[model samples]
Target: MFEILLALLAGIAAGALNAVGGGGTFVALPALVALGLTPVTANALSRIALVPGALAGAWVCRREIGPVGPTSMRELTAVSVVGGGVGAGLLLVLPASSFDAAAPWLLAFATVVLAFGRRVSQALSDRLGRSVALSSRALLTGQFFIAVYGGYFGGAVGVMMLALWGIGLGLDSAAGNPMRIAQLAAIFASATVLFLVASDALSAPLLLGAMLVGAVAGGYGGAHLARRLPAPLLRGVLLTTAVTTTVLYFLRG
Candidate 1:
């Protein structure tokens, strides 16, 4: 009962964070690890559980979804799906010790990105005096790599996407947010399929179901709430979550 409740609350927080700005894995992955699942299994299960939440957020923002710069939405999504599947396959094939060793570093890297990605994007934009327009090939290539990261150990992948778009396409994060949510759904959906078929995530069915239910509710509500919350407040919440998660992971290591 305690584990179920904990997972449910973590899922709610994770789903809300993802809907607002990303970093859902920062919450869900750690929570599952605390529940005694191995790091690799926790990562896979968290991705599986969050799929519905990402989908719910995407559905709510479907009308606002659009292409990122020179890349068409269709092509970008295709790349994300393929890259995500490949990443998931990598996770399944890799040794569990490798994920355990890398988990803290991945969390730290994600936290740094969440903290400074926007500032860096803005700075680059200011220096250039215009959006650095990447060729479509470049944009797709960048997105594919990010999707691979998302599939392997997504933490702030949505924020990373927004930062890339902000720098390369001069797209505003607010304007690109819906599309971020949609692409997140695509990545997680692909990853989830791989996890279900190839991983041991289903071994903890109760916890997974609890988290999934909470994530769905939170995602739907968070998408609506995100429109109303002040931007600074949302960023503050996300940064706090990211920082705290990263710190705890480092300490645990």
Candidate 2:
């Protein structure tokens, strides 16, 4: 009973951490494991626990949904949603060991994009500018790949989303919130349904209720904090998180 309560409180903190920087999973995940859940179960529980934070972040930044196209918003949102669901479904059949092993590499890849994301975004934007056509099918494909990675081991989905927008969508990674939030929306919805449905231990009533409250609180706090932080600091946070998560996962393995 006390453990469950602790998980809730800890989850909120993790959500805030995630919202602010990008490494809340490291915090919430370890806490869940220490509370006695298996890694896969912990992963599922963590997903359920963080949905509220993701949704809140997206809602707070609703106005920034995508490029100036009429259908851009629809495409990004739809891709994210479908990709998230597919990734979540993959979680049920895929071996956690495989995802866990690749976790460090994923972190490294996302972190590299984060570190140089601005330059990449600028260079790409200069070439394509704001007029480059966004390929929905390609974007959706990327989203699906990212979603699968996120579902299996979502250590740095934010960084990945930022890079995708910058590189793929020809958008300013640091400026707008809509595209990234939309991706998060997809991640949250799919993860929520997957974990809540597939993971036996995570399907508990008390846990889910607590997870819900904690996620919402943390997500709200995270978004507010993110909104206040400058780009330089946020990038620094991403760098630190990337390195820390990489080390932690490798050490754990």
Candidate 3:
């Protein structure tokens, strides 16, 4: 019971951090493992919780996301869905222990990006404001890869999506937020289905339920704050969280 509450609280904090900064799982993932889940189970369950939060974030940014046009959104979302499903399938079939052993290094890399992600995002938005300009192929390729990574492991996925959108999609923050949210949703949606269908009942139901509630709340909060706060400040917070989480993870090592 205490562990469930801890997970719920950790999720809420992560959601709040992600809502404002991005990558709250840096906080939640390790905590879940500490509470007794295997690393892969913790990572997979994190995706389950992420769905509602992504939806909440997208809903909050709906008006801003409108400028991207229905056609583009529909098309991009379809690609993301397919890519995400494939990635999730990969996770289901592969031995996560090998990946799990290497996860800390991946998290470390993600932490590096978290520090400068927003600044890089702003720069990409400004410099390339040049739209991949009807290059359907580039868009498809980049989005698919991002979706796969998003499904496989998500800590650094946002940074990756930013790069894909910035270069291939030539997107600005307004369009990017909703699109990214939708893409992330697809990623988790696929992973969640995979878990529901294949893996033995891996996570504790109580922990899953708590994370769901916390993620929903945190997602709403993060989305709302993304606009209210200055981008640089948000970036700074994200960077700090990434570094802190990395340090904590290493401490356990």
Prediction-by-prediction clash tally: 0, 2, 1
RMSD after CA superposition, every candidate: 0.8, 3.1, 2.5
Where is model 1 more than 4 Å wrong at Cα? none
lDDT of 1 by residue, 1-253 (tens): 9999999999998998999999999999999999999999999999999999999999999999988887899999999998898889889999989999999999999999988999998999777766458789999999999999999998889988998888888889999999999999999999999999999999999999999998998898899999999999999999999899889988988
lDDT of 3 by residue, 151-171 (tens): 777786766776656654566
Model 2 C-alpha lDDT per residue in residues 66-87, reported as the tens digit of each score: 5522336666666666767777
lDDT of 1 at 87: 85
What is the lDDT for 114 in model 2?
54
**Cα TM-score per model:** 0.98, 0.81, 0.88
Worst 10 residues of 2 by lDDT: 64-73
Whichever of 1 and 3 has more TM-score, that candidate is 1
Compared with the true structure, all predictions reach lDDT values of 0.92, 0.68, 0.73
Ranking by TM-score: 1, 3, 2
Where is model 3 more than 4 Å wrong at Cα?
A: 66-71, 118-134
Between candidates 2 and 3, name the one with more favorable TM-score: 3
